[model samples]
Target chain A: MSTSADTVSMGGGNNSPSIRAKVQAFGGFLTNMVLPNIGAFIAWGLLTALFIPSGWMPNEEFAKIVGPAINFLLPLLLAITGGRMVGGQRGAVMGAIGAIGLIVGADIPMFLGAMVIGPLGGLIIKKFDGLLENRIPAGFEMIVNNFSLGILGFLLMLVSFEFIGPVIEAANNGITVAIEALVATGLLPLLSLINEPAKVLFLNNVIDQGIYYPLGMQAAAEQGKSIYFTVASNPGPGLGLLLAFTFFGGKTSKRTAPGAMIIHFLGGIHELYFPYVLMKPLTIVGMIGGGMTGIAVFELFDAGLVAGPSPGSIFAYLGLTPKGSFIGIIAGVLAAAGVTFLITSLILKMDKNTEETEEENLNESIEKSKAMKQEGKEVSAASEQHTTQIEKISFACDAGAGSSAMGATAFRKKLHKKGIEGIEVKHYRIEDVPEDANIVVVHKDLLDRAKIAHSDKEIITIENFLDDPNLHGLLERLENVSK
Target chain B: MLGEHLKGNVRFLESVNSWEEAIRESAAPLLENGSITSKYVDDMIQNVNTNGPYIVVVPEFAMPHAKNENSVEKTGISFLQLQEPVMFPDDKEVKVLFALAAEDSTGHLDLISDLSGVLMEDEARDELKQAKSEKEIIDLINSVE
Candidate 1:
């Protein structure tokens, strides 16, 4: 069951995660919630691709799956899952209830609204649950919880119908008008500036599911195909970046980008490229350049697709293309890749760290470690000397995934090698950390947050989580307490 | 692994007033074994106080752990089956508590992986819930893989 996310306050301190982090987290959360049901989306895409009269093997009877899949099941599932992530079973119920408003209020499929409304409803129910926690008397808990959700859900449903329903309809209309105007004026390529960045930030599903899918469905129902489906869902820009990174980027990118390229361009999981781009902010300009070129090429060729490719797979894009439009689609993809590669190669030249040979790099790290250990012994012997046992050591980060989790694992391995016993080392999201944590290890970027969260506790900042030299100091302090 | 703790540390508690009490009861065996320090126990209970009960990880089950690296004297896992379920603030009720203490993050991973395997199988979890003695619980764990 999903609970409300601990609200992270922004604009508080320089060390707190940026506004970009919050948006990225929200996008990450949405991506995670929707990812499990990718198969269902594929099923709908397949059905639409095969049976839509102009399809490969048109079958009207089998095509019946399209309506239910698009109109009800997809959005219904998204709401339940998104809401469940926010609240729990109660939240899921209310989120599903609230989502029905967007579904019935408009002629278009309301998957985007479901993504928002369900989570919002669940969050509201969770807030109510929090306020009433411990206040509900024993034996009367079940009834009160049930009645509260029922009343609150009903009120939310009304609010959704009366207020939210119309608002979404109007917003959808506004966007549609805007897109039509852009397309008419040959200014549609400008959308790549917004869509490409959002896509790399992992808002691909929201753009595809919320905006592209519904609009494409409407257009495809009237015409044979919709260019709107191909606009944001193109795999070209990401492929371009990966190709450039594979051949021209630093050693790390050169090694990893090929595998990522395979997963992204071929497998159609656009998310594989996000981390790569995130690691190098300057690389986004390459993606933006590629995205604009892709759109421009599509416009040049007048290319469109029968359906939105679920994973934005290159193969699926080709399959969905009209008989005569195959060259146009291929041209757009190649042009996007060529443009991205040219820009990326230039940007990567400024990346100086990856130039060192593996042996030299290893030697440098070893020398650095020796210097750090020498420094660590003195630091441990000084004012931070342990007088009492530390029961808890928490490795905290923004999302608590990459750095903190790996740091804890590496630190654990170090402790095991040292024969250290009975120390609980774990990774946690900064906000979810328990107050009982004796020592909090956080990234230097998150030091301010750690200080604010645990003012009384020891806050250790690690500049590089992967090879944190301060871990030795922490271990030395732990050993001193044990002695 | 969990086998050592399961053989001697597993217990069936008759009753508990609150979730905190249940956690304390669950960790008592670990504390007795010197697997965890007394301060670790307090910290574990305090984790719930601060973080709410995200510990009820699976249905009818709770895995209460603390970030108390210093409180850990050994790596161990203890089981406590409550006769009556204790409800957390989130309205989720839990009957089984797996209190884990690890001196380091990498230690006791095999035990956790095995326990998760047992928990995933409905029949195994049911067998665990019904087993009255530690030997039976040990047998159930052995039988899973």
Candidate 2:
């Protein structure tokens, strides 16, 4: 049931196939370039996790490992990789040179900034290479190439320092101001409200890579660890929800929740549990409660991480924890789990009838969808003002497969039973909704997210894919337009 | 558990022209057994065509099925193995097809879960792929229990 929703960001255009292709190409580049280096990132995570001052190796010699790795080597390695992706060996060197400029000139990790500058440096070098392709004399090629590269490296370093460096610093400062205000107002835990929902919406990258990474790098550079790194990356809330579902859920939950828990908690793909929460929007309170609990304990114990854990794995969590603060982190996670379990159990119990209604709605929608084929004549009469017809209907979920795929199957059968032909129906991950999709169907909980991602597209929200009356209404609308 | 229904329902075909042909050939046994109507087979094929290949659960496996809409007379599963795999447009190739017809969405989940459990075991899957007779496939399903 694995769906391709987590990574694909669709263009919000019915006519813009070019825009869709560009978005897909960029998404592919980002995923291919960055995903392979996760091992390196995890290794860096391990180093900072275990060798920091409060870690297993508290010796001064081991503590020395944290500085150069986080501040220089890791970011430099990432830049080299990104540059190699965009250009070749020469671009890799310029990318590293550009990153080094940022590393030396700034107080933060500079890794996030490197991702952008590295590609830019690589592109510049590639352009230079292209310009000089046949212009250099054969005899003086080596000399010319070496001297020009040195000059280019120096120029890129200047560009990183004099230009991009200040912009990054300013962005970091602005985020810091917002965070400091929250902390100053004694509302740090309130971040959980925003963070948990955003994470479920698959906006973890925006919050982590876009905002927290720079701040965390700066914080880690100053201190041994940064709490900024741990704020949203913690898996405790997700773990709590999954645990609750496994123990106290319905039949489907009991069957699937355990597998999801292992993948989510240990494997560190928190997106696995998002559908469980989406199935019941009321359970978001559990997530909020768990998040608040974890953050509260982190603050109370002053527990922090040497670097941001990408997957938020427990091993990564412990690896980054300061010496005595390990217990605090554990306590925070357990407390979050306990609170979430209690809230989720209650919500699940209360929503039993609502869940039943959802199932009924699904069956009803199927019946109505089938009825549309027989009632095609009635639809054509209503077509006078309806010109915007939906050519394609796509069902989208967290990963795009489990619920949405099944829903699409049921819907398709309904259409076929009614003798409705040629209308395309497909399923995708919410992020990967195809540009041509006229109506994007998503679980009700993801309505806000679908809107944010594709504001111009017509979206249909259902409590669950099985029982949505909206699908029938949408088909009626489509029929009117089709006529 | 699935072995009881697999008696006289399992077949290993030499080849097929397309995935739709493979699906129809797989479901033929169930249709003969009165487990499903011909409409059910058409609906299942239509599902695969419209929704891409979500049915191809594993590298070389697919379970082609559709939701019940008076097309299913009973819950049944027919197993077929092709000598050469049929390729779907999505790059998923299916050497084995499990044509499932359920009375309702939740009706045959337990059987599906049990079947998935067996399919996931490499040893069981390898045995099923190579088995020439129905008894061997039944024995493998029994061993899973």
lDDT of 1 at A31: 64
Which DockQ values do the candidates obtain, in the order shown?
Answer: 0.02, 0.02
**Candidate with best lDDT:** 1
State the C-alpha lDDT per candidate: 0.71, 0.70
Worst ten-residue run, lDDT, model 2 chain A?
Answer: A4-13
lDDT digits (tens) for residues A189-242 of candidate 2: 888877776665545655675566557766766765677777788788888888
lDDT of 1 by residue, A284-318 (tens): 78887888898889888887776667778898888
iRMS, candidate 1, in Å: value is 10.8
Model 2 accuracy (lDDT, Cα): 0.70
TM-score of each: 0.50, 0.51
TM-score of chain A of each: 0.61, 0.64
